[model samples]
Target chain A: MEFYPKLKASIEEIFATMIFLDLTAAEPLAAGTEDLGCHVSAMIGLSGDFNALLGIHCPAKVGLAIGSAMLGMELEEIDDDTKDALGEISNMLAGGIKESFAGENVNLLLALPTTISGKSYKINTPSGSQRVIFPCEIEAGRFYIDFKYSPR
Target chain B: MGKTVLIVDDSNTMRKIVSRALRQAGIDFSEILEASDGQEALDVLAKNKVDIVLSDINMPNMTGLEFLKAKAENAAIKDIPVVMISTETGADIIDQAKALGAKGAVKKPFTPDLINETLGPLL
Candidate 1:
């Protein structure tokens, strides 16, 4: 199934209603350029019908912007609140994706979300895995919603 | 007298957002309590008098479904109303939640009006 549109709609709805931010969807990033200079990332694992990892990657400024907007407080730096905010967003995005799939009769279970942040880091998926990184632009900057899944 | 509501979710960000959304929804509450997981929610319920519960189904320590089952088993808190606010609002899960005593559900990325609509009648 083509998940890009489903994921994109989820992103739009989340930003519109919860974060109170307007965003535009960019073209899906090419495979080789998965890195978007992201300083922070939040990920959650999925199981059941398929095994997958869903993540939201953001640069520092964009992360702060999203976190601040989500919590209705200004976030000066990447802290627990920022991580938690992104993680919850990841969780919500995954849920949206799951709901989309459920419409097609796919079942999925979600794991608790986790965050990764620093000056530098890399995420490597297993060989033969499929992945898509959807870029989204808000006022502060661009962020990516990444979905990697094992071929069913 | 004003009502007290417990917001249960692992994410501090979500708890804050739910609280803010409740205010935006124009729901008045004397105090709002928080818990990161079902166990913590149980602990809070034991210690405080919460009029309602808004919970997330996917969580660590104890999931919302497990929490519902546990809450059903407990005589003291069994009758308190719980409305799920989560992304896990699939028919099977929601049906299970309802069977376990969840009053209703509000999906993630919800608006203030949606929150008010789902939770207003119960209050």
Candidate 2:
């Protein structure tokens, strides 16, 4: 079954209800595309019927905007608060995807979320793994939600 | 006097969001306490009088299910009602929580209205 729609819906629901942000999703990026020039990212691991890594990548300004809206405060810079916010968002998104899979009897367990933020960094997956990167746009800029998983 | 509620989640952002949602739900609570994980929640419960608890399932030190088991054994605080707020609302997990003494569960990405609906009856 296709999981891309589920991922897209999860992003839309989270932004609209909790983050209070407007976003439009673009087509999934081609496999092997470069990182989205994002300064911060949050990821969570999933295991069970299948093993997968789900992540949300955002530029500094975009990350701060999301954090600010979520907390109902203005954030000047990317700090612990911003990282924590994005991490929680990643957890929620993973949960959303997990719930969708559950409907089809594909059970999954979620790990705690972790964050990575710095001037320069890159994420690489093992060869032969499958991935889908969804580019989403908010007023501040663009962000990506990538789901990479091993075939069962 | 208004009720005092405890929110247990590792994410500082989530704790803040839950606090705001409680207010938006129009549930007047005199105080809203917070703890980063279930272990901390136990400490807070030991010191203060919390009317109810909102907890997350996955946490670094002492997950929510483990907290429920510990809370159940402590006669002093066993009776206090707990409602889970997490992305993991699958039936199996929620059933485990309920068996361990959790009163209810609410999924993540929830709204003020949903919070009220789940927590209103218990208050």
Candidate 3:
């Protein structure tokens, strides 16, 4: 099965269900290009049947709002808790995608999401030379997930 | 009756959320303990008395699998119920968690009600 369309569907489902948004993009970022908006990064490793990296990058303000909603407190600073929450969120989104790939004989190994803060950054991976830039817009701010895939 | 809880996860955010959820659920617990990863969790088992363990699968230093391996050998830790919470979609990992003696599993973005429902009577 092709990964991109399934991935896109998965992203739409995850965001709609969890964050209450419908994510749309001008186009899927090329395999590996370091061009993304402000967001949280959650990456998981795929191995066994499938080997690749999946991540979710949410705009900073959106991330904060999500964190704030979870914490039951206003998030003024992007501290340890906020970063961890976003990482976990990214992890969940990847997990959501994995379910769609079942029966493909592919497997997965998810890692703890490494939280990155800032208005922008570049993601380079060993698997895919080009980073797929994800630009997300929300009420608070904009962010995107940088996705890369490598088959074993 | 207050039960004993063993909270497991590397993230302070998640751990605290689990703890707060437990409290929010009105599931009074006699004691609560923290373990950073599976290794520390095993070490923790050596000293503390806990009823249910809520764990996260991935971590630095020691992933959740490492803890399960240790649990298989340790006669005592093996019996304690483990619940995994992660955004990890891999079925193998979930199977591993069960094979390692986890009682049940709950995904991330879990509500307090879900926690109560999953661990309610036993916890």
Candidate 4:
């Protein structure tokens, strides 16, 4: 929970400076539920001080919007461009988190980012992991950043 | 003389952002090449005369540090200045990159101005 504010600030800075979009966070979403609709999802694993997973989940439209804005290339649908944008956003988030917590007791490394896109799917976290969801709204649409972590 | 720059990153999106930043920084380039990893970057270098290499530290197949070391050891590509742009923020890693013959290192979530300042003199 303490990290969510830092996470929100990081997302805002990245979107405003890198992607040319401004994001507004909504009330934190209910966490620990597998019933989520993710049209586009990009995930990167965290290792070191603690083991965890971080992901960006958004609808197809939001993904396309972000891709188009960041690349200055027109994109109308969910394609490689959109998927790549989603993955990079998640990558940036994971990297930001790692950098912010670098001085902590544990060392962390981020895994390569992977993207998945579909109508709807469930992301199951380890039962013991602590899960938090930060729901945010952008000019184009709404998206969510999911953080799941557990001490290794 | 116009230059040629190669961007090496596994994520296509990060590559786009880097390329865009370079363009926005007013760096004139005759060509901008891209590769998914270090080995692919070597292949690109084999075929093209790249003036600068912008790379990510963590990638599949071959990492940026590995690529920089390879470039340093190669007779043909040894002089090409490499600037590392990565999420890695450790001073030790940056120092290691410098030791491996990197011209400079920029941490991730970089702004356009940061990119400009880092690469301007080298370019």
lDDT of 3 by residue, A1-152 (tens): 46666666666665554444545644655454465555455566656565667666765677788677656678877777788777766666677666666656555655556776666755544444534545655566666665666556
For model 1, how big is the iRMS in angstroms? 0.6
Clashing pairs in 1: none
- Give the alpha carbon lDDT tens digit for every residue of A20-107 in model 2: 9899999877545375688999999999999999989999999999999999999989899999999999999999999999999999
Off by over 4 Å in 3: A1-42, A48-50, A118-135, B24-26, B89-91
**By summed lDDT, which 10 consecutive residues of candidate 1 chain B come out lowest?**
B21-30
Model 4 alpha-carbon drift over 4 Å, by segment: A31-36, A121-129
Tens digit of per-residue lDDT, candidate 4, span B11-83: 8888989998988888888899999999999999999988999999999999999998898889999999999
lDDT of 1 by residue, B1-123 (tens): 789999999999999999999999999899999999999999999999999999999888999999999999999999999999998999999999999999999999899999999988998
Among residues 3 or more apart in sequence or in different chains, the pairs in candidate 2 whose N, CA or C atoms overlap within 3 Å are none
Ranking by lDDT: 2, 1, 4, 3
Tens digits of per-residue lDDT, candidate 1, A1-152, equal 68799989888899999998989999776545344688999999998888899989899999999999999999999999999999989998999989999889888988889998987545544444488877798989988888888855
Highest lDDT against the true fold, candidate: 2
Comparing 1 with 3 on lDDT, the higher-scoring candidate is 1
Give the alpha carbon lDDT tens digit for every residue of B62-120 in model 2: 99999999999999999999999999999999999999999999999999999999999
TM-score of model 3 (CA atoms):
0.76
For model 2, what is the error of residue B26's alpha carbon versus the real structure, in angstroms, after optimal superposition?
0.2
**TM-score for all predictions?**
0.94, 0.96, 0.76, 0.92
Residue A27 of model 2, lDDT score: 86
* iRMSD computed for candidate 2: 0.4
Candidates, DockQ: 0.92, 0.91, 0.37, 0.73
